[model samples]
Target: MSTYLPVSGWCYMTNDLMKEIIRVAVEAGERIMKIYEGDIRIEHKEDSSPLTEADRRSHEHIVSELKKITPEIPVLSEESADISWQKRKSWGKYWLVDPLDGTKEFIKKNGEFTVNIALIKENALAAGVVVIPAQKLIYRADINNGAFRRNYDGAETKLTADNNLNTDNLKIVGSRSHQSELMQTFVSNFENYEIVAAGSSLKFCLLAEGKADVYPRFGPTSEWDTAAGQCVLECAGGVVLDNAGNKLQYNTKDSVLNPYFIGMREYNEAVLSWFKALN
Candidate 1:
């Protein structure tokens, strides 16, 4: 049965709705995997980021499913992101999707890519679902509902970020593809920390599952790239703060590019200070 919580005027987050979103993400992942197992043709966008058939197929599947599930809600996908700001600025709630988050990782066949879906209400993350197609795992969260991780065999584990504030032995997750000089400088501030290199939104899931302590993203990312992961991490007792030390928001401006941010299990004055110093 579907249960809903009226979070704001005319906005609701329902358990059944979340389930449907997850299903959409999973089905999209299946489509991507089929292409992943075959000849992967690559293309480039205006920004030169790699694109593949898997990306387009997954985008089509997810967008189609989401529209069928909730015809009223709008959808903004990385593949079909040409929607004008004037058209999107008025959307009180919509689906923010990144059909293929780690195309590079997928091209490398590293099995670290994922399909991301998030619900944005009033420019805030209201719900999210991330499906790791290669690994057959899913992470999900919603407003007022705790986060959870579903395994391949239908097992689910409630996720909670590790509250360990031990900066001496912090496990910082970093991007496998986009590395920056600022990231190295930021890590130099840590006396004893190890880097957990990962691709796509799995970095956020690592924090949500208590597998990693923090994720500092010093490179470029879009709103769709982090919205679903941010919701999962935040719901699991974590936080994703922009350089300005505010929660990362969605669809706030004309450009979809997001500010550099940090995802951590809990608030740490030391980490925040370090980030501020670098910025």
Candidate 2:
């Protein structure tokens, strides 16, 4: 593997490197699945989120493998995110990972959890790989390359977002665990839309593959939670926008928490106006 310099852009993300990252994510997912099948023990984080042995095992495996693959680049995983802002502020390029997203759903045995890994270049998502362990699905994307969905059998399909937005009957995807009043208000604006409830980063994959048209996230989320999925959606001709209607970015602040954002198959001015009117 070639050593990548901490450059300003995504020039270092080659197809081979993307493949290696995908392999790492898939292996991490395999580790998680082993725990998922057995008697599970769950712990609670200080923030009250569910933590499991699978998260720890996956985090350790991914961090160790990523170091071997790109020793020069730094990695920041949700499991080991104790690095100070002073240290993180200077990182022009780094790996952002969420070993197990939708842990609540994982505990529910709903098969909606995911492993998310993303490359951040100059505070923007350069590449990402998301693996659904139970479903044996992979979604990957890069800044230059388009998005793809790969099956366990190695069959791959190029993903394209459904750019058409039907106001009368929209296909909207929402969080299965974190529904809030703000999200309700946003959805209420559309009189005839159907809800497509999903957990973790699968909502983004749904938009990437044209299965859903929009995802309105009104509740709180961390940077790791959205980065990989956002990359996949954006590379598939979609947009994940912050409240200000700008592209959602990463690592630009002290907190890892993300602001309220919307994920759509494509940029729609009317939708933006509707979201803005809510505020």
RMSD of each: 2.7, 2.2
Give the alpha carbon lDDT tens digit for every residue of 1-279 in model 1. Answer: 223223344325676677778878888999999999988999999999999999999999888887777877889999999999999999989999999999999999999999999989999988899999999999999868779999756888899885776899999898655568889899999899888988999999999988888898888899999999998999899999999899899889999999989999988978987987777
Per-residue alpha-carbon lDDT of model 2 for 80-120, expressed as tens digits? 99999999999988999999999988998999999999999
TM-scores, each model vs. reference: 0.94, 0.95
Regions of model 2 farther than 4 Å from truth: 1-9, 176-178
Cand. 1 TM to true fold: 0.94
What do the candidate models score in CA lDDT, each in turn? 0.88, 0.89
- How close to the true structure is residue 28 of candidate 1, measured as C-alpha lDDT? 90
Candidate 1 yields a Cα-based lDDT of 0.88
**What would the C-alpha RMSD of candidate 2 be, to one decimal place?**
2.2
Supply every candidate's count of residue pairs whose N, Cα or C atoms clash at under 3 angstroms. Answer: 0, 0
